[model samples]
Target: MNELGSRRLFFKYAVPQMVGLLFNSIYLIMDGVFIGNRLGRIGMAAAAISVPVIEILIAISMALASGAGIMISDRLGRERLGEALRIFKASILLSALVGSAVALLGNHFCHGIAGFLGATPGIHDQAVGYLRYIVLFSPFLLFSFLLGGLARNDGRPGLAMTALTLGSLSNVVLDYLFLFPMDMGIEGAALATAIGPVVSVIVLLPHFLLKRGRLYLEKATIRWKDWLDILRLGSPSFVMEFSIGIITFIYNVAIVKNGYGEIGLAAYLVIGYMMLIFLTLFLGMAEGLQPVFSYLQSVGNHGKNDELLSFARCFFLAIGISCYMGIVLFGRDFISIFSPEEIAMIDLAEKASPVYFAGFFLAGFNILAISFRQSTGRTRSAMAISLLRSVAIPPVLIGLLPLILGRESIWACHSLAEAGTACYIFKTTRRNERWEERWENRLPRYTVEDERTTRSGPSTSRST
Candidate 1:
């Protein structure tokens, strides 16, 4: 595809996936509403408390799928379909195994954390009941996310969209049935969430089995090196994504220490749902950009790619602006869905969310930077960004902010960390060119794409 064609193709897949995922987001919000309305505030709070874990699972799944898919696409361009296919198959197996373990182990861990999130005796059983069903469905959730990523990279974003949409919609219907029709209580809500992914998988299986894509999982492709590569490529993402859980735990502590309780928990949950929406958009763009970045590199259009990266930065700025506008205009509407009980809670959340999301504009930049680093196989650079932004920054901000500014400083950590991460990302953008060059010659570019016309900027979404 030419420059215009490539840009068009990028939007084609990006927009639909965006819309389809919107439905998925709505379903989550709806589930929260149903659970909150049916279950008591503590029960609702318990489910809300599980947000970090949910996001962590999502991040891990995305890391594996997107990271592997990025490499697979690059390999396909290089005509190493065998290696690509091997990685694809290995990712699925690894994801399933890991997901299964999480199902078994995650429940008890969640039970341990429940007290912190406000799961008292009254709501305790309901909370654990909710956790149980979702744990059982972990494999499907893992499969759904991985398959969605694979479908996107394997050149059938429609398939991924179908899977995601089906899963989201099915979850809503099943939620109503399980929660209301069958009167399964919190367990019903959990079951619905689990079932959603199964629907998604059903939509995706046909595409892979039919061999309609350039890269796919084949029986011959399951190999250790390939699995290692997927893990290697995915590790930065795993760090970046899973750190959300770690950081969120920190945030929860801050919220509690700062004295919010179930009220605080509910407010955070409201804010979290909105964050998820913004995060999904940010992730979608970064993911969509990855394949484009890889494709351009393979074809030797580095300069033009540099231009594309600049344009993407500009484009991302527009996204940030839109996010800010969404928060300002619809923050109340969004939060009310989760915490309809207290107007004061809504007002407080409204005040905090904008500050938290103000750095959202910068997050896209961080995401862009991270995407570039990972796509080109610059593992060290990728990992540095991941550790700094995901692990290091949040904790440092949480630790110092409280001591320096007093307890309320806890509330400031989210925005403070985001701003800090953005600064580090900006610095990396400058130094990363040299770093990328170290891997430049190491990864063969000419093997794929019409590289002659394809321009790659500094490389990865970071430098790109």
Candidate 2:
């Protein structure tokens, strides 16, 4: 990593991460397709109802993974292998404990949780059934994310990509078999989703078990301070991911309140899948380069950091533009893949796409800014960005937009939130950069004065 150039490093990590996450998103879409085709609108709606639960699980896992990953990367850069391994082990333990607790609690209250997630009586049973299987296997899902992230920080991004890719492939195949051949309903979909992560964890285990990288499985005494630190540093990532669930939940409620009912949810489900794919791409890029960012900062290589940041800015900007354009042009076709027979849902999603996705061209940039700040240890800045975009702004817009601009404008909430976040980031970043520039400009004068004082002693300094 120290010897690699910025461009080479970016591709080496970012490309694999993007491909792996892209595959993961593809399988998620496949799940929707199968559910949409096999069970029609009710099935799609039920799955959509359960989305918040799934996303919350993912957020928790990512939070742990990201926090520990950053710390491990920093430790390794400083040649502190022992500390890095300790953090890795602690993260694994935390993931298991949290996953098991969630599984137990979630299954016990599956029906209630489904209802809370806005599952109507029509899809309540299906929603509970799906949510049950997901929570039941939460441990595996958490492990998959935790281990893959650790692998990347351990300097084996290829292994991480391979593990995630294989897991996703297994999911697609299992989704078909369970849904069609076995005559299982929504539970089959959930089962396949749960099992995919088990495969990912299985593949990642060997890498660590064989000591292929800096991190390996071993007995280590966990500390409360370590857990707190992990969660603290990883809070931004948690918020970033959790915001997805929150957004979906809020949108579901808003749609229902507006009298759109099941059909509206079905349409939003398709749109949500589109959002997921683009978000996965942006997140993949951010996560893939996170270790590089952390490593550079640890080594005080500010020049490389700036170069990488510039490249990432351009990359994310291009993606954001392309995503919005592609969705605008081909959204109808994509919606049809989910439920070709449901022309009404397809039409609704088509119209909503342009309005809802208008600001996505800047969404990637916002994600990049948050991840960059987190990776470089600007935790407060990162957390602020995550909260503003995901928590503070979107909910307010979702509530106020329809009342002010009329009901149809509700779809524009996310776009507005993205645009608002971009503006905030742009202003703050420019301000910080200007401050940095002024400090840099003053450094030479300060150095020269200090040298003159040293040569002439205290009397000369006083005379001046």
lDDT of the structure predicted as candidate 2? 0.88
Best by TM-score: 2
What would you estimate as the lDDT of candidate 1?
0.74
120-214, model 2: which lDDT tens digit per residue?
99999999989999989999989998898888898888988999999999999998999999979998888998899999999999988888877
- TM-scores, in order shown? 0.85, 0.92
List lDDT for all candidates, in order: 0.74, 0.88
Error of 1 at 428 (Å): 2.8
How far residue 132's Cα lies from its native spot in candidate 1, in Å, is: 2.3
lDDT of 1 by residue, 253-289 (tens): 7778767786676677678778767766766777666
**Residue 111 Cα positional deviation in candidate 1, in Å, after optimal superposition:** 6.7
Root-mean-square deviation per candidate? 7.2, 2.8
